[model samples]
Target: MRLTAEQIASFHEDGFLVLQDWFTPDEVDLLRTETYHEFGNDQPGRILEKNGAVRTVFAAHKSNDVFSRLTRLQKMAEPAAQLLGDEVYVHQFKINAKLGLDGDQWEWHQDYLYWLKEDAMPTPNVLSAVVFLNTVDDFNGPLLLIPGSQKMGTIDLDVEKKYQQLDVAESWKPTLTADLKYKISKRTLIRALENSRIVAAKGTPGFVVFFHGNTLHASAGNLSPVDRLSVFISYNTVANALQPIANPRPTFISERDFTPIAALPDDALLAPRNGHSSPQREQLASLAG
Candidate 1:
């Protein structure tokens, strides 16, 4: 599950890395089933688009047993600790749901901007480990990343001016929507493209992508009749945990606990569904009971 020296170097240079089929098909099926259970529920973390389709579900790890175990997967947490070179904790965990035909576009932006402004994060030493729950293709709204954009440092964005017309009381909610409040302007995006090119992250259900917190990325709306569901777990170095800020975002979006993650065994996900028997054996026993 550990990354090689060459792979680490590539991540440092490109600000992102892709690991194909990181999860088995059976494990993905289990995760996919758990993810769908979060939607259309009463949880305050569930966010919806203007079209009434689900956009994101925050803190699934906190509510579901399967996702709670997912947070500590060795394949994800180990590499994150290696990349950050420090003990890492969960900063935020959510699943982005871009439903078929009803999905909306996400504007280009750096994730660290929100963390810096909202949570008072001191540095850009955080990264996101994402797991694709469905096949992501050109027609299904795959993520678009700008190579080497993380090295640009934080981009100066005028977030306050764009949402000046809206009420401050509700301004925080808009930032999580399809049209991001802290969006990178076209002028700045053009300047970025001059130095780096955009690449589409297309893969199957088990695909995983790790990107730096400062990486500039976005995605178009889903045009085909397929859903694009991906799980995002943002890990921040313990040394770079957020400083206190007034009017902090909801706990679901920004985790309050700063405990370092202790990864489970590599085969944790593929373990038997029951305590000490195969899934079929457990099912038969239940019938006998």
Candidate 2:
């Protein structure tokens, strides 16, 4: 779990690192079974599937034994602690299953961008660890990352609008002006020393990938017949500031009561609102019970 100097440098420089076979086959099977069991039984407010499986937020300590065990593993927590400097909390943890059929592709956006709201100060106290629960190949649409994009800090809102437009248009073929803007924006964030490569990381079920919160990443639609499953644990240093934004009707736990975990200096990120109650909250209340 102790990252070598080279591994640490690669993550800092390129915004991500891939550790092969970080989980054993048994661990992967246990986690996968528990996740599927939890999702299938409709355990209160557990799984949310619009196009694919998205679990709501659960306190790290309060999660099921399988999940809690995964977090306790040194191989998983050590690198996370290294990045966040020892004292950290699991701000979020959930199972994300992309069924290899016709799920919606995610927009290319920074994880912390939603936090940049009206008047909030940012904190540098977050990182994410994604443990592949199944072997991920191009057929199942593995993750794609923009190397060193985290150093770009938060992307400009104006520029993000352009990316969104292109994404929605499903236009890999851009106009001259659009292509120029894309190149300029992409160039500014990527590191000169590193090459931008789409990660077709095919590893054992237990392999783990770590990335900075601001890293620009996207996934292609799942077209294969099987499901591509991943368990994500998001860690945040205790010193990180948190605020809550109001949610009138929330489908996910993150949208309802979860607080923002990390931010950059001078940026305003929205946090979850405190003291909220709704049907969704009531459903999730059983986790505490």
Candidate 3:
């Protein structure tokens, strides 16, 4: 489907767009079935966690058909072409399934903040598509976004310092470790917004949500018996190259730096850049399968 000028403007203004029924019902069912099957069987040596009644499974790319389909979907590729104005490459992809009543809440933050190192200009070519495989609601932890926040760019070091001070004054320790402090700071920033609202996205499956990489978004803990599953794919324009770097944070983290594709064979689906696969991609594939 063609995007209207209004939709495009909304995206530009708010850094995100929620398209209803972007995928067919049949397609959504297929993905959901595949994901549940994979999670139940525990393929690819992946782990499953259950907090109270909520259950979740994680996987990487090249290990599952769900991720493969998501990365190759024309619905995603078409809009990405319009947004990036050139060929694009998949930077990361994953399936996040929150089942039951015990899913943990996600803190508000720009995704790139987790990737940034030292003091560098944040890349602008990146975008992400979150495809809902099931209905999402307050009880199941629907996503929340702060409109126009992407324009704020990366979190300033000084702003972060101030947030820390506030956290200390409030005697609030979100997570047990300093590594999680950044995520807490993000939540504090979003809470400060006067017009924030919970994303009311629930109902038919295959609804795709696109957001700028720098958009501030998060979700509450799942408190329902029904499951909430979403396929998240990270995309980047060909003009931008993925930079590889080692973890520079003082605390232990789970994510890795993505690199550009080095070369491409004629039959390859994705055009080559100068980078390689990241560990996150591997995990996504494993879960998808």
State which candidate has the highest lDDT: 1
- Sort all candidates by TM-score, best to worst: 1, 3, 2
The true-structure Cα RMSD of candidate 1 reads 4.8
As a TM-score, model 1 comes out at 0.92
Q: Could you tell me which 10 consecutive residues in candidate 2 have the lowest summed lDDT?
A: 263-272
Q: Give the alpha carbon lDDT tens digit for every residue of 1-289 in model 2.
A: 4889899889998888999987667667767787776566554345444544553323332446556546545566667878767555565566666766844454455655543331131564577799888888877878778777787787644444654565432322221111222222454434422656545556768788898878877677678987888877777655664555343212222222233222111100111124466654443334323
Q: Model 3, range 1-289, lDDT digits (tens) per residue?
A: 4477897788888888899877777667767876777666544323334332323344444566445545655567667666656666675565666666655667666766654532121476678888898877767888788787777776743335644565332322222112334553645574547565445555567788888877887777678997888877777765664444342321112223333223222112222223457664554336434
lDDT on C-alpha atoms for all candidate structures: 0.87, 0.58, 0.60
List where candidate 1 sits over 4 angstroms from the true fold: 160-169, 272-289
Question: Best to worst by lDDT, what's the order?
Answer: 1, 3, 2
Winner on lDDT (2 vs 3):
3
Q: Judging by lDDT, tell me the better candidate of 1 and 3.
A: 1
- Report the C-alpha displacement of residue 91, candidate 1, in angstroms: 0.5
